[model samples]
Target: MELDDLDWKILALLQEDGRMTFTELAKRVSLSAPATTERVRRLEAAGVITGYSATVDPQRVGLPIESIVRVRVRSLDTPRFRTNVLVLPQILGADHVTGDDCWLLRVVCRSMVELEQLVEEAQRYGDTTTSLVFSSHVRNRPVDISIFVGIVSR
Candidate 1:
């Protein structure tokens, strides 16, 4: 699992563009295609590279509105609340955080009415405070693994 400079370089390139071909990745990292492929396989085997996925624009797909919902629930209801949230298609992501709110959810909908309906459904499990997003300054950004790698390798 020890990653050298080449491994880090490979990871950085892949993070920037997961769809990059092995030949192109090899060219950038100064390795043969087969060697690069082997390195990537090793990284995957070590669980360093979990999976590859395509990034889609929710707005372009007709789900334009996004909202952040902070949910407060009784301790006994946490598990059931999470299970409910998982099955809800509007919920893009949910996290249990330390605060007045037991959970925070990123939800996307086509309209305000849809957003209201989603919130009402969530209210069955817990109380929710919803905030509509006007614009996102920073969406999903690639993680800078160098910091963690340096700390771990030291």
Candidate 2:
């Protein structure tokens, strides 16, 4: 979609706080509440706004250990690995990337034993390398629109 300045502003504000009401959003964007609602709906219809979700701290949820598991799966086992990985609750997210590793997974576990077991399960497919996350400098920062300012038409 060709988003204008107002649309970008709405996106920025929504990304900051998805729960913001249309009335407040309209006030911020200098538009009527109905207009703000219409724009938001249009953005949603166009698939620009996918969905809203809550950010939960793993530690508070009894899952403190965070690890990045890099798996280099054998060519024949890729499909099976992908299907099985989703069933593992410890895996928070996975990315199929380019490089020596076929899959990069973000996992959280209650204890080291669980993490070890997870790694061992992955090793059944192929080589595995796991690293515990000490700290995350940027967990889930809002997208910086400035980088796409010139690239995307206003």
Candidate 3:
């Protein structure tokens, strides 16, 4: 979808806090509340705006250790592996990337023992390399819109 600086501003605002009302968004974007609403609606319709989600702290909910697991899955499509592999609660997320590793997984575990267990579970698929996060450089920040895609508005 073609978006202007105002639209990007709106997205930036929403990314920071999704609960902003149309009135507040209008003031920030320098548009009328109705206009802001229409723009957001159009962005959603065009698929530029996917969805909103709350970023949670894994440490607060019991799991404190976060590990980035590099996995080389024999096959991502294997039903057996997909089923059993996904059942592990420690796994925060899994992604397929183009590189030496077939999958990159995020793991959140309560302790080192659980982290080891999570790695062992993934070992059956392929090699596993775990990187424990000490401090996050970026905290679930919004996508810098200008980088990945171009936007030009009327």
Residue 37, model 2, lDDT: 100
**Shift in Å, residue 110, candidate 2:** 0.3
Model 2 poorest ten-residue lDDT run: 145-154
In order, candidate lDDTs are: 0.86, 0.90, 0.81
TM-score of each: 0.89, 0.93, 0.83
Residue 7's lDDT in candidate 1:
85
Encode model 3's per-residue lDDT on 1-154: one tens digit a residue: 6677888888888987898999998998789999999999999999988987877899999988998988777774446556777678788787878888877888899999988887887787778788988888876677776663554322
Pull out the clashing pairs in model 2.
none
Instruction: Put the candidates in lDDT order, highest first.
Output: 2, 1, 3
Higher-TM-score candidate of 1 and 2: 2
Residue 103, candidate 2: alpha-carbon lDDT = 91
Task: Please give the range of 10 consecutive residues that has the lowest summed lDDT in model 1.
Answer: 145-154
- List RMSD in Å for every model shown: 2.9, 2.3, 3.1
Q: For model 2, what is the error of residue 35's alpha carbon versus the real structure, in angstroms, after optimal superposition?
A: 1.1
